[model samples]
Structures are given as structure tokens and as C-alpha cells.
Target: MSKLVGSLQGYIWRGYLMAGKNTNKLLSGQATISSKSYAYSAKEIYYSTLPYAATYHKSAVTGYDPTKTKPETSYGAISRSVISNYQPSMTKAQIQTVIAFEQAKKSVPDFRIVDVPYQASDGTEMVPVVQVFSAPYRDLDDYDHDGKWTTEATVRNVLLAQENGSGKIFESNPEAQQVELVGPQYAFPDDDAAMLSSNYYGIDNTTRIIKRVGQFVMLSSRLKSGIFYAKASDLITLNTNKPTVIDGIPYVTSMPLAPASPNHYVDTASGKALKAAGYTKVRTLFDDSMNEYRLKNGVWTDSLFASFETKIFSPDFDYRHVYFNVSDTDEGKIKSNKVITLNEGNNDFKKLLMAPTETLLGK
Candidate 1:
């Protein structure tokens, strides 16, 4: 039997395509069925924004001969494996409801609408998601010139008709969905070398680097007390070698830490340290918003912890801004954004799928 294509992040998975087969093993937490009208499973799959355009030769950067690599015809199409997890037993009405819910909540930065069509092995219908933009690239020279790739094939943050206007939309839709595409990012799973790649950062910037395990340092976000501390660990490699201590607490520097970049945070190495230390998740509180990241199978995952209507204060200007140690039941006053409700469909959403490639690429 031929293997089915499943989107994890945005990369295709081969044999591990079945949605329910050993699902318990794949998820860090137990799976449960929701009782809402738009009922869905609580099973979480580690996903990232599709890191590349719909059709780029996989062998381009690896220097592999194209002739030797069997081309993937379904390279950019959203696969059934992803939609099934959203609602393994979803009826057509339920599927449509899910789509409506996503479209209504599109204001969330990472929220995307699954607009393509799919079918299950059992002949069930499934809807697909369109990725808002391709993965972030390093430079125009490397992504466009040296690689012989178009800006449409590399750049991110494409404008959509729904978000922008009809004047900015890509004509030929990639026929794909929003899920993590597992690729080179997982190759060097055990080292900071993976962090060196520009594909990791969503924006173009000089990638600061550090070497050796001892160079790792942890910094706290600036607190109300105007103090920040750093701690060193061999479990991960940080971009800085400098560690400063204030009030018996070591910090990366006397600076305010923002949770914009995970590299400035920690990689899988540090993720393991966090897990082993009995921390369920790391919450990065920035101004009015808080985001949660988890390490499953030694890979860091992106998840929103909360969106505070008012600024979040850590009670004291201390480590609470960055490193969080708490149980799931201690959510205090933070509101959960996972609730989904059905709404009328938006036709502009379909145009938003692939209408901004040229605009984003500056064509």
C-alpha cells in the first residue's frame, strides 16, 4: 500500500499518516472528544506554518540530484491526516462549522482557515487549510538568487484579500493547508546548529550564535523592580556567553526580555531541561499577551497561553515574566482563546488563500 501524505508543521510524513492509529503515543497529553456543537478532539499535533512555497525542489539546498529524488506530486496539497485530527469523525456539517469558526477567529495571528477539500481512507469528507504565508527566509540573495527560487517561493507575511484588499492576492492557490512541514529543522535535533538556520526566524535579522554547552545563559524579563537575572546551564547553547547576577539571581544581562523569538528563549535542549524540572509549559508574558511553548519529542512547540486585556504584572518584577512554574489549574484570571463558534462563511476568505504571493515577494 502506498503511504499517505500528512502535514506536520508543513512537511509530509510518510507511513505515519493514519489519524487515529496510536494517536495516544503521538500526543503528549491524552485525547478527549469535545461536547460542543462544533465538537472536535482535544488531541494536539505539533505544527508550524508551512516553511516553503507550494512547489520548490526539495534537493535544491541539499545539493542532491533531482533525478534521484522521487518527486512528491502532493507536495503542497493539504492532506487528510491533518483534517482528521481536527475532527476524526467530523460530519460534513461539522467540518463546515469548523471552517466557519476558524474564519471568524482569523484575527488571531496564527489562526488559519482550512479551505481545501480532502477525503479519509473510510471515504469521509474533509476540508483543508491554506497557509497564510510561506516560511521566513534569510536573505534575498540566498533565497532568490543563489537558490534560483522566486521571492513568492521564500518570503512570508503575504497579504490576503480578507486581511488586506482584493488588489493583493495570489492567483494560483497552492492547494495546501496550515500545518507544520517537518524538514531540515529536525535534521540536527540535538544541537544549536538547527538554531543557526534562517528558516527558524520569521523575520530577517543577523543570527547571533553561541558555541559549547557551558555558554548557555538564562535571562529574566525586566521586572517592576527594574532588575533582571541570568542563570547558566549546560543543557542548552545560548547566543551569549555573558552572565550577570543581581540579588543572588544570575541573568543573561540587565535588559528587558521580550518573547518575540524562541532562539532568544530556548531550543529543544533547554526544552528538555524545562520538562525534567517538572515544568508543564513555559509562558512568556509580553505586555498584554502571553504565549505558551511546549517541548514534545524534544521539539519546541508554539501555543498561545493567553491574551490579557490589561497588562500582566508578575506580582513582583522577578523571574515570573519568563520562567513559569505552575499547574494547569492555576490559570488565575487569564482567559482561554480556544473556544470556537460557528459563523456565516466569508467568500473573501477563499480569495485570501493565495492572492498575495507577488505582493509579498515585491513582484
Candidate 2:
């Protein structure tokens, strides 16, 4: 079998060439079905946003008037407008350049240093290393230098274009690269990120990174919060250091939702940490907005219909925010923004599945 090109994310997967696999995973949580064959994952996780341009409405009177019949609501096509939200991922060359600059951080002021890990030949892990970096710099003094850096590239041009050898700025790097840049974090399982992978954020569940079979590339997503894809050549290399992914495909299952121990949000890493210990299913709250999702076999699922729970402040702690929790009864609330509480009563909130009981094919 050959890798199927992902329609949404554009990467090729080993299993079915499903178009919405990643999106479905993002929209729901987990692949629609399991695969026994090899699946390709990625180093740079990507989230695709297809602009949804549809007809919108302008609200008008809805009540019926005694003198005249109620007027029908008018609908019109939404005018296409420029959505400036496009921040393309950094290129490998750009990543390398930035890493190189950060490698020599003393030159830059007020820079944030990031820590990353490298592995040893003996399968032992090397202590995480730190690198400090600042934003890109440009020198307007020579606007057209034709260098890789846009600011540097045009330095000479600016000088040539000037008359009487007049130039305004001495250095541009301080301004060009002044933008806040976050160094890459150690790729660890994250639950909040997993929830964001699906709709709304619509980062798509294909957010996690899984490398395709035998490629320098590791699948990842820009939607996965502060993480974006760059070619392997662009990534900084350390001895025994390369990006890692869960399966061949960086789908939702890779997020670490699994059998958990009670209150062991303890040392348990993200995704792997579940509220109810050893639970196969549990209700999870998402964001301030009441979005709910499910988890199973390490994969997150979109089960919008969830039981609502009522919560009160912790008796022992200085509680401020109100918490909505799942009752011991499963029939109540199916979704929440956080793990409020669980009850094992006839409602067994833990067993709630996003898919309706009858909607599920085989128990």
C-alpha cells in the first residue's frame, strides 16, 4: 500500500488516503477507523484553514404585525474580505539563521533562552541545552546588499539608491527581528493542545507530529500552539537529536489520552494524564466556551453532546472560579471545560461516549 495524501494537511499517510483524516481527527478526535498498516507522521505539525465564505444574515423584525404579514428575512452573499491572519511557518533556512543568532545570544539584548534535548548513542538522553535569540535585524544604511536576510539583502540597494551618499539608519536587525519569537519546546504530550486540535480552533486533530516512514520530515502543525513546521535542513541539529512523533501520522491518538490513575494528573505527562484513574472514557471541558471532547486509545474524540454538571468551590481551598463538573450520573452533562468531578452512579458520567449509544455500530 502507498501513502495517501492528506487533503486537509497535504501530507501523505500510509493508510487510506483520507482527505479529512486529520481534520476529522481534529473535528472529532481519533481516526474514524484503526489502521494496521504503516502511517506517516511529521516533524512540523500543520493546520489547514479553508476559508468558509458563505451567506450571512442581517437581522430584521421577526414579530408578526397585525396590519401586515411578517416580512421574510433577507439573505445575501458575504463579500470576500482579506483575512490577514496568514503567518506562514518559518522556513528551514530562516530557522537555522535564527538558531544560529541565538546560539550567540550575548550580542542580543533582552532575549529569551530556550532549552531543548539531545540523545546519546547509548539511548541515554542528554541534558536539555539552552540557546538565546533575538529578532532578525536589518541595516537600512545599505538597503540592497542582496543577502538572504531581507533587511540585509537590500542594504546595498538602499545605499546605491541614495544620493550624496545619504543613508538614514545604521542598523536594521534590531527593528527587523524585534518581533517576539518563542523557542521550540521539548515535544511532550499536551492535553490542552489536543483539545484545540479539533474544530473551533479547527487546528485539526492532525496537529501532533508523526513522521512519515523513513523521511527526514516529521509531521507537525502550525495550529498546535507555538509550534510550526520547518524542513529538517532548517532545524538546528544536535548529536542524537531529531524531532519525534507518535505514529506514522501525527493524529489525535498520539496526544496521550489513555488509562489513567486517580488524581494522577501527577507525574503523568500530558494526554496520558486523565482525571479519573484507569478510566477508558471521561468528560473534559474545553476553554471558557463549554466545548467538550472525548478520549480513548490515546486519541481524542469530538463528542459535542455531553452531560452538564453543577460545581461549587473547593471546601478546603480559596476557590474563585465556578466549576461545572460531571455528576456520578452519566445521563446529566456530557461535556465541560475541565474535569469537574465524576460520579459512578447509574449515570456513570465516565462511560459517556460522544456518539449516541444507538449511533455506535458495535458496542
Candidate 3:
């Protein structure tokens, strides 16, 4: 009886070990099967959706060039055409009345009008008066080498001189003879709170007048009635309270106003003019704490605050005529001063102006 009991116990122990091994093998096989199934499903889904996802993902991974792609109808072109062609059924007098009402609402008390003269195509004199709302309080001793800050009288004198000249001012081109100031002069309040207020907002409002240098008079396009100094033969018109028809030509106050200069502030602490400072493409310092040390001859020194230096050279008295050079350890000497003359066949100026707008619109 004792032997039979021991044998039964031995058989039970062996059965327990075999069951444990079989259970582990079943679990391992199930795990392997589950992993294979998951991988197969994942591959199938990826392959199936590859055709659909390729349209969006491919362009993102590889940079897209618009010039290389086929031309497509753009929304800007469509919208511009629609806006230009669409006209309200309102009468001309009604439209003028509405415009007058808007102008009356924006009438500034401190603003005064100054008439600028321009010669018309038919040898007739035209005057386009601009509303001067603000002028520099501090007198400029010798700004622009013209002996003083630009004023209405000074601008007029410059234009008169240009008109009296027998030969063109620019030797290479006749159209480039006239040099007009094409930017906002007034220094508006930088405070955002003051800008939001209606009273202070219109107080700093000023107009941009394109007066030819040495012939200081308003300029107009030769083919059109607008204020555009494209050629020497461009006409000048008289300023009126409203668009007035003198003789046979209709004279209207239609000139593009220049926006305020972005580089309006000067950093007095650093003795650097914010807008006048040269642009740096790369940073030299490895850390922000190294700003106190300056890079000299490829070695860092604690004497200066900057790691690099920039120099701007203006060859002629022309403000636009400028050449810039930067000195750095990484780049020994870099110069950037390529002149692009705006002649009859050259569209470089137009391309430069449009490039920024196009990049913004594309994004």
C-alpha cells in the first residue's frame, strides 16, 4: 500500500511539470501569432493608403519650387480681376458725395495744404497740394547735404532747378534724371495706446509729396494724370479743393502715399542707429554669456561688447547710394553694394519691390 501511494505521488509530480511546460509553449506560440498578425495589418494599411498620402507628404518632405511646377490659376488673380471689373450702380455724383463725407469726417484742424506745381504735357502748369499735418520741430543744420531739413520751399526750389537744366541729370538715362523723396518724413508716436485713440491718431497724419530734386515741384506721369515721376516729360497739375477739369484735362489728387519708415528709432545706449545698422546673417558666440567678449583675430577678447563690426560707405551724396562691408572671424571680408539702374529695359527694381509681397502671399 505504501509503495503504491509513493508511485502515485511521483506520477502526479511528473504530470504537474509537463502541464507547466505545455502552458508556457501555448502562451509563446499565441504571442508570436499575435505579433505576426499586427505586423501584417500595419504593412497592409501603409501600402493601401500610400497612394492617397503621397500627394501631401511628398511635397512637404521635398521642398517645392513654384517655377518648376505647372502654372495654375491663383486666388489672388481671380480676386483682383473680380474687384477691378465689379462696379456699383451708384451715380458719379453720389459716389463723389460719399467720398466728400468720408473726407469731412477725417478733417484735421492742425493740417494745412501746400500746393506743389508740375508742368503738364501741353506746357500747362499743374499744382497738386498736399496736406501737411506735421513737421520736424528741431531744425536740421545740414541734412542730406542740401544745407537743411527738407521743407516745402526747399523741395520746390530743387524741382525748379531740375526743370531749368538743359541736359539730363543722369547721364545714362533721361527718365532717371529726377530724384524724388519717396518716404514718410514725420515721426509718429510709437505708443500703441496713443495710436488707438482717434484724437491723437489723426494728429500725426501727414502726406508724402514726390518733388523732383533741384526742381522742387510735384511730378506726374506723362501718359497719366497721377503723380508719378517716371520720365522728364511727365506733367504737373494744380491742387484743387476737389478733382477739377481745367481746359480739357481732368486733374485729380491721385498719388500713392508712402508708409512710415520701419527704422524710425535710434538706439542711443549702444550709440548705434537701429535701422542704419548692418544685418548679420550668422551668430558667432556659442552662448549668450559670451556677448561681453569680442572676437578679435579668431580669439575672444573681453574689451568690446560685439563679436563683429560692420561699415557702410556712401560713395556719392545719394542716400540710396550705399555699400556695406562686415568684418568677422568666420567671414574675413564681405561686401554688398551692387547697383541696379532702373532703365527702360531693366525690371530689377520692380522685381525687388514685388519679391517681399510675393513671398508673404505664397506663405
Candidate 4:
């Protein structure tokens, strides 16, 4: 019988397709639910603001009289006015662009701009004007042709030069020779020893020595107290009173334990080592039986011998052919052994089966 020949199998196949549809619906529904929640929250905020606005206006107009029954504007009318005036004027795309711009501004601190309201050329209505500051510069003389600096370094240098009387003055026209240095007015002592002898003049010898000693100590500690080399065999404790035994293996005092090298039996050269250790591909039943031992369950147990069907024949025979002139039968048998029995109503199994096929088919 064919593996796909069953009503239950057909149902399972169709169930996989249905599961994909359900998954798409679920994902789309999640977006809808989020949008609905946001709308509900906005509605709640809009309604909540009405009472506060009503109270504030009533208190301001009527001086918060306790005996007053009603305000000049009804609460319902205030709510309606708020709802009409406070309706979102910006489109979704515009809102998203604003959000993105705000996020970008936060991430990149150099980007700064402000919206200034200005009257139009017609002088009828006010329009928003985007005023952008000069981009930050990293060095002096890094300004554009318009003389707008684009880096922080340029701005800092200009400020420092201005304070030090070395900056150029640009009033109507540029002025030259703006900075000038004069000769020092104070005199210096001729004797270096007399200058050193003055206690308040400079650091004393004792303080210098203390500073040097502290620096040396810090450097030595950071360098792990100077490097020292030793052989691996010499890394052993010489304590005879307390013996070190790990995992039932006793280590001799003052004697180094060399780590065993990993066995690389996969390499051709290393396979010879396995051969030297008496490991072979073929072994008789008696040779195998010799390795079996009686377990705690009072039963002798040996290594399991697993047989698989294969077309190839070799000296290393892990597989055995049981059927003669029946390759199709062998294939069928192998496929039957590997059959995955999924439940009819299992959505997970359906998704697993359909997702990959759909992805491959570009569905």
C-alpha cells in the first residue's frame, strides 16, 4: 500500500493548509487588537480631559462659589468642543515621520532644530518656520562658504581664541593683526638651586620620592608583580601532610601530573594507535562475549548490535541486506520505519509540515 493512501492522511494534509490560514488570521488579528486598544485609550483620555477643563473654566469665571448650580458652559458642551478642537490634524504618515525625527534627535545629539511661527508673506495667517542651527564642526577654519561652523571643535576653538585675544573680529569687514603678544614683565631667578630650595615654590624631594614610589607600586601591581616562567611539571604543591586525591586518583606530593593528550582516531596516523590498542572493525561473537560482564541486576549485558538495510557493501559492514532482488521492498521497509505518525487535529504538526513547503514554494 502507498503511504499517502488514507482518508485520515488526506485530512491531515488539508489541515496543514488550514493551519497556515489560521496563523495568518491570528497575526493580522493581533495588529487589529493593538490598534483597537490604542483607539480606546485615546477615547478615554479625550473624555477624561473634559471634566478638568469644565472645572477650571467654572472656577475662573464664577470664583469657585459653593452655591453655584451650573457654569456658563455646560460640561457636555465643553466635552464636544474639546473633541472637535483636539482631533488629530496630522496624518498617520506625518505622525510617524515626527516620531522617527524625535527618535533620531534623541539618538544623535548633534541634530538640533526648532519650529518658529512666523506670519506669511500675505500677513494673514501664521506658518511654522523650521530654523536649523549651524552643524557642529570638529576644528577651526572648518566652516562652510557661508561661514557656518559644522563641528564642536571649531566652536570651542573660536570661543577660546576670543577669550585669549587671538580671534579675528568680523564687523562689516574683516580686520587683520587682531592678536599680539608682548614681552614678559616679571623676572626669573638665575640660581636653579635657590628656586628648588624654596619650599612653597615647587614640590619637595620627599614628596617627589613618595609620588615616584606610589607610581612604581601601582605599575608593579598592574604588571602582576613581574613575569615568571615555570615548567608544567613543576606546578605541584610540596605539602606531604595533606594529600590531594581527585575522583579516586591519588596525586603524589611534589610530583607533577601530565595531562593526557586527546585521542584523534579519525586521523589516519591516529587510527594506527587504535589498531595498536586492539580495536578492529570485525570481531567474533566469542570476542564480543568476552567483554560482557554481569551487571548489578544479576544479568550479563553486552553492547547492542544494530542492523540497517543498505545497497552498498564494504569490508566495514554496519548494514546487512535481508531481501534479494527487492530494492523497492527494502526502500518501502526503510520508509515505513521512518514514517511520522502525526495526529489528525494537531495544528503544530500541520504548521511544521506546511511552513517549510510554503516557504520553499514562495507562498
Candidate 5:
């Protein structure tokens, strides 16, 4: 069972959804309203499906028409009517770009202007990992020679300036350029309840101190990582030669992980445990109380707060970006102990967190 990126949220889940592996089996066998009978107003589906703005239709001109009877209701019917949204599953190369940017900015503070939900060329308006600079926030000041916190610019300029991929991919193919430009931006919500803040800066809704530097470039991919990111100078080193042939194929030079720190995070104990289980490039996230480990050999290996509330770094194994996941919460609260196994480069594998804890079991 090969793993593939999940179509809905863009996280790497187990098995290939296209191949129809564990999808149905993973389901609760629930049914939705649209799955049942007549067509509901697109408006209803819009609000119910996306949570935000209301989607309305033009009112009928004059008189009323049909007097049809309303149908039965259930959690199954209404909720299931959800329109599954596909998000950007960036390649290993793309993921590294975000990581490099974040790594570059180690001192800059976090900043937010506005949230503008957008639709990609793919017709999906998934959460952007980064937003705000899409249109220049003319009011904000533009500063340079600092860490990742970029100065304000119009939204459009931000998008263009923040593009990824070698120009080669775009030089010959305009269609491909459109696709890359519109990929998902991983948006990290400052406040789930407060929604959006116009002038709110440096403070969480409940007044908790929110870390300005986002470890992972998620929710929206359009917002490029700032200079304060980890990659700073060590991310990708430029090579000078174009090899005539490798295994028969000519080699082209490009940026690759520069192998910055010798400090690979791993618990010799956890390392021994997982290695005994056949894991490679496996490392741990730890502190005073918890010790969590994730395998880097897989396609998508993020330290998801949906599992643990702590932070972790996720880079593509083919050695692309280094997306860090740094959380402000306590280590014990994180869904620490788990195993993510894979079969191929950065986009294929299984995420299995068998024991959801960070402590050692006496057994």
C-alpha cells in the first residue's frame, strides 16, 4: 500500500487515494445530504461547506413556484454534503524552499495583515500556508537586510515575488507556471475564534504570546517564508558543473540541501527503538518531558498538532525544504510517539502513530 498526499487537507496520509487503497475502509460509512436526493441551494452548500461567507443566488423575479415537501434530516445528510477541497501537495523541491526561507529568518518577528482566500488554477481555494503580501499593504513600511518578516507590499506583487521553482520550468511552459503560482498556501490561524484581525499584531486572541516565526510554511504555500527561516545560508549550495552523463542521463546542476547542522535531533533510545524496527533518517523531538520521533525517509512527515501540539521540522527526503514545526505549548501535550514509514521520495508513505505518548513504557 503506497502512500499519497491526502486530497482534502494536503497532509500526507497512508496509501494512495487515487489507487483507492484505505479510503473506503477508513470511512465511517456515513452518507451526506447531496448524496441523497434533490439539489440544495448552492448557497446552503457554500456556507455549510466552507464556514465563512454566505453564498447567495439571484431571487426569483415575481411569484413563487413549487410547493415541494421538505425531506428528513440527520448529521449524516447535512454534513456529508461537504465539497471535498483539494490542496497543494508541493514536490520535495518546493517543500525545501519554504524550509530554507524559514531557516533564514531566525530573529525576525511574526507579522499578519489580512486573509484573502483564493482559488488556484486547479479551481481549489485551499488554506494558504502564508498570505497578506498578495496585495501591497501600502500602509505598512518596507524594510530589507533583515530576517524573514518582509515589508508590506501589494498582494499581487507579493505573489509574484514569492514564486518558487527554477525559471526553466516556466521559461518554456506557461501552463505549468500558472499551476505552480496557484498552489495552496498553508495558513496558520492566529485565532480560530477571532478569525481575522485588521491591526492586531504580536498578540494572540486570549493574549497568549504567539511566536512571530512560523516553523512550518503551511495553510498557504503562496506566502514565501521570510529571511529569519532556518536555511539562511546553509540550505542549498550551488554546484558548478553539468555532468555529461550519469547512469546514461545527462546531469543538470541545481540547489540541494547543503546539510547545515550536524545536530540531527534523535533520542538514542527512540532511535534504537525505531531502528530496531527498520527506520532510517529517523529523529526525535524532545525537551524536559517528552521525546517524539518521526521518519524523514517518507514523502510527508510533519509533526502535526492534530496529533501533538508541539513544533517539529519537516523536510522532503529527496532533500528539498526544511519546514520546521515549532510550537509554543508544552512538550507533554504533543502527540509525540509515532511512526511514519514510506516507500519512495517525499510523496509516498504511511503515517502511523501507534502509541500516542512521549514517555517510556515500563513494559
Candidate 6:
């Protein structure tokens, strides 16, 4: 979610650029694979353009590994495996652009290297960047458990240059000092995929309710049956003026749909229809915090929203139900659509919390 500052020099510049390039390659590869694989049949190609088409044409496009005794086969499984195995291969245009950029980089003087300072929302420089204990890639003595072969300095420098959380400072000069860094953030790919698939037939995954009560940060004490995620800062002030001393977090919350699956293909038909109807499908998650709704047959419907989690493969089709958002408009759709619920029984809740597995962040 962080933007690369292209004008900066040193390791941060290279890391950001490489990370951006890798991300671009991964996305392009996913699109290409999805396009080619879905062309297996006319029906599949047509269905790929439909809303939640993954559910409709998964079986037809699926192939098996004959060598395996059980041959676990599903279009989602096979296509995702293929996508994960792809290597970065830049197009001619991309190569040309990279060449031009590298040429430009060589022209910049060492003295002109830019170092933007990061600051918190309260205009404080005491910001924390997650940096695992690892040495540089060249050293090879240490490795990031997250699988992003970046060093601690590379992670810190790149994160600081980006304008995430709080914005970066541009005008004034600030003193450079060491800040306490946190440990690594683990990746749970199977959990992520299971949640997104919403068809956890043989998989077991759970969500934890994290809360901060005063100075102690711990799991919620009373909510035994549900899960919730909240930042400590957000829970600092309790409005006592309200009838209740504590307010409950929503069981389900919605974000702008960001398809994390490598097998997730663009539903151009649905996208075009929505655009013609004055609605645009957004790629950024959490941009809209309200539930979205559509008007159908003179009635407001949430069928489209529910379709994301409801329409899956057979067998689980009847019982595989996750909390879904039902809305009729884009207004506050993220807030209204609560597909990701707090119940531990709902494994699909992990879909919102985990990142896609193929990328650097996920690794």
C-alpha cells in the first residue's frame, strides 16, 4: 500500500523500485494466466466475464496431476499453482521504460540524494517501522522469515520513504536517530486461501479478537464466541456519556472488494454494467467503508454483495455460508457490507486480514 519515492537515492530507492516492479510483474502474470486458462472453453471464457464466475466454471477448467494418487483438482487450485510458479518476464515496453529510468538514475548526483523524514499523525517523528532481525541480501547470513530477502535497513528505509499511516515530512530538517523496531509478521497462505475460497471443507482456520484495555494489550476478556480486530489507539477513549461504557465493534465490516486470488479474473461484463449504471468497481480495499446495494426489479438488492462468498463449488454450496453484505447503493457500502464477521466459526473472516500469498508482502 506504500508508494515508492522514485527521486530518492541509496538502498531504499532500489528496494522500492524492485518491489514495485515485482508487484507489477505479479499482477500482469496473474492477468495473463487468468486470460489464457479461462480460454479452455467457450463456456468458461463467457463465464469468466460473469460475476463470481470462479464458482461457475471452476470444474470445467480444472485439470489433474496424474502422478498423484488423489489428484487434487480444481481450477482455483491448479491456476493459482501455475501463477505462483511464474517468473518475472518484462515486456519490451517495460524493459525500455526500465532502461530509461536506470539511465536517469545514473545522471543524478550523489549530493542531490533525497531523504524524506516520516512523521506520525500527531506531527511526531517517533514512528515505528517493522524490521525483522536480518542482514542485507548480499550478506546472506540472515533472511527475513517473511521471505522478502530485504535487510532490516532496507525495510526501515523503504517504509520511512513511503507515506503510509502518517505522511512523510518534506519541508523541514529532522535529526536521524534509531527507532525501536518490531519483530516479523508471519504469513499464513493456506489460511488466506481458505478464507478467500469460502469453501473450507477440509481446512481449519480461526481468527483472534485483539483488544487493548488500558495499559494491557490482550484478547478480549468477555467475547468468547466472536473475533474482533482493533488498534490500541482507537480504543483509548471510551465515551462514558453513551448508555454503555463500551461499544461493540460490528460483527461484519466491508471494504472495497480487492480480489486477492491469483485465479481471480476480471468480470468485465459486470464491471461494464456497473460503470454504465454510474457505479465503478474499485480495486483498493477499505476505500469505501459502507455497504453497496443494487436496484433490481424495483427493489433494492444485496445479491451481488452476497454472491462473493455464497457462490462456491458443489458439496459446500449448500452449507458454505459466510456473513455477507446486502446493500443497494455505493453510499457507505464498506460500512454497511459486513461480509467479514467476528465469529470464530466463520473461517472466511481471514480473507480480509490476510494478504495475497504470491507477492513480496505476503511472502
Candidate No. with top TM-score? 2
- Superposed model 1: Cα runs more than 4 Å off: 1-94, 105-127, 131-250, 254-363
Which digits, one per residue and each the tens of the lDDT, describe model 2 over residues 20-120?
A: 33422322232322122111123111111111112112212221111122211110000011000111122323223333443343653322111112222
User: Poorest 10 consecutive residues of model 4 by lDDT?
Assistant: 191-200
**Per-residue alpha-carbon lDDT of model 6 for 31-135, expressed as tens digits?**
422331111111111111112121222322111111111212111212233323221232223222322332344442111011112221112121111212121
lDDT of 2: 0.24
- Residue-level lDDT tens digits of model 3 in 1-363: 001111133222211111222322212232312221110111111001011111232232111111122221111111222322221222223222322332354652222111222222122221212122232233476432211111122222223323443233222222222122211111111111010101110101121234444322333322222222222221222232232333332222221111134422222222122112321111112111111222244332222112111112323322112111112222222222122332222212212221221231233
Q: How many clashes in each candidate? A: 25, 64, 19, 7, 61, 18
- Please give the lDDT score for candidate 5: 0.22
TM-score of each: 0.17, 0.19, 0.18, 0.13, 0.16, 0.18
RMSD of each: 25.5, 28.2, 35.6, 37.2, 25.2, 25.2
Per-residue lDDT of model 1, residues 1-363, tens digit only: 111223322222322222433332332222231211111122111221222222334433321121222222111122234323333232333333433443455362322222222222223233333223222345756754223211111001111112222221111222321111111121111221111111211101111122222333211111110111111221112122232222232222112222346344334444455555555445332222234444444545553333211012434321101121121221122322232111211111112111222321224
State the C-alpha lDDT per candidate.
0.25, 0.24, 0.21, 0.19, 0.22, 0.24
Which runs in model 5 stand beyond 4 Å of their true positions? 1-110, 121-244, 247-363
Evaluated at residue 59, the lDDT of candidate 6 is: 27
lDDT of 6 at 50: 19
Looking at model 2, how many pairs of residues clash? 64
| Candidate 6 residue-pair clash tally | 18
Cα error, residue 335 of model 4, in Å, equals 98
Instruction: Please identify which of the two predictions, 3 or 4, would achieve the higher lDDT against the true structure.
Output: 3
Model 6, global lDDT? 0.24
lDDT of 5 by residue, 28-147 (tens): 222321121111121111001111111112211110111121211111111111212222333323333433443355642232222122322223221213311121122345532211
Worst 10 residues of 6 by lDDT: 178-187
